[model samples]
Target: MESHLLEVLVCPLCKSKLDHNREQQQLVCKADQLAFPIRDGIPLMLQSEAISLSSSET
Candidate 1:
């Protein structure tokens, strides 16, 4: 992911900062406990497309 793009991207639900998980190619929102997937270098920021993080993940 591009650093510039990552800096501007935020969680679509909570509008919070996201941490990049390079291995999974996802943007993780710790506050919202959601993971937004990145496909073909584009982030799918839609809430419906996000995966909820488990309690153990937090």
Candidate 2:
């Protein structure tokens, strides 16, 4: 994801800032315990597309 884009992207549910996980290719919303997928550098910000984060992952 582009730096500018990442700066503007937030969790659809909580509207909190997302942390970029480059290794996992995801944009994680810590507050919501969700991890939005990034496919080919494009973030899927939709709530339906977000995966729930496990305790260990957080």
Candidate 3:
């Protein structure tokens, strides 16, 4: 993702900053305990697409 685009992208639910998880290729919002998937170079920002984070991650 482009730096400018990533800068503007935030967790849809909490509107919080996201951590770029390069290995998983996802945008993680620790505050929201959600990880938005990045598939085929596209970020799936939909809430339904997010995976719940483990309690240890929060």
Candidate 4:
């Protein structure tokens, strides 16, 4: 993902900043415990498209 894009992207739920997980290719919202997938360099920010994050994830 581009750094510029990541800087502007936020969680759709909490509107908090997202963390980039390069290996996983997803944007993570720690506050909301959700991971928005980045497919083909595009972020899917919808709640229904997000993956529930386990407490173990950070």
Candidate 5:
């Protein structure tokens, strides 16, 4: 994703800033403990599509 897009993107649930995980290709919302998927270069920001973070991830 572009830097500009990442700057503007936020967690859909908590509306908090997201940290980009380049290795995992995910947008992580620490506050919500959710990892939104980045599929085919597109971010799936929907809450329903978000994956709950593991204990180690939190």
Candidate 6:
């Protein structure tokens, strides 16, 4: 993901800052316990598309 875009993107559910997980290619919202997937370099920011983070992972 581009640094500029990463800087501005937030969680759709909670409006919280996201942490980019480069290995998984996802933007994680720790506050909301969600992970937004990045597909083909584009972020899927929709709440419906977000993956719920496991308790152990959170």
Predicted model with the maximum TM-score? 4
User: How displaced is residue 57 in candidate 6, in Å?
Assistant: 2.0
lDDT of 5 by residue, 1-58 (tens): 8899999999988799999998999999999889999999999999889999976985
Question: Model 2 clash tally?
Answer: 0
> Which candidate would rank higher by lDDT, 2 or 5?
5
The TM-score values for the models, in the order shown, are: 0.90, 0.92, 0.88, 0.95, 0.92, 0.91
Candidate 2 residue-wise lDDT, 1-58, digit = tens: 7899989998988899999999999999999899999998789988889999987896
How high a TM-score does candidate 4 get? Answer: 0.95
Which residue pairs of candidate 4 clash? none
Candidate 3, residues 1-58, lDDT tens digits: the string is 7778889999999899998888888999989889999999899999999999997864
Candidate 1 residue-wise lDDT at 43? 92
Candidate 2 residue-wise lDDT at 49: 95
* Each model's backbone clash number: 0, 0, 0, 0, 0, 0
Q: Scored by CA lDDT, what does every candidate get?
A: 0.89, 0.91, 0.90, 0.93, 0.92, 0.90
- Give the residue spans of candidate 5 off by over 4 A: none
Superposition TM-score, candidate 6 onto the true structure: 0.91
- Misplaced by over 4 Å in model 3 are none
Best by lDDT: 4
Candidate 3 achieves a global lDDT of 0.90
Q: Distance (Å) between predicted and true CA of 4, model 5?
A: 0.7
RMSD of each: 1.1, 0.8, 1.4, 0.6, 1.0, 1.0
Q: What's the alpha carbon RMSD for model 6?
A: 1.0
* lDDT of model 6, residue 55: 66
Tens digits of lDDT, candidate 1, 1-58: 9899888988888889999999988899999889998999989988889999997875
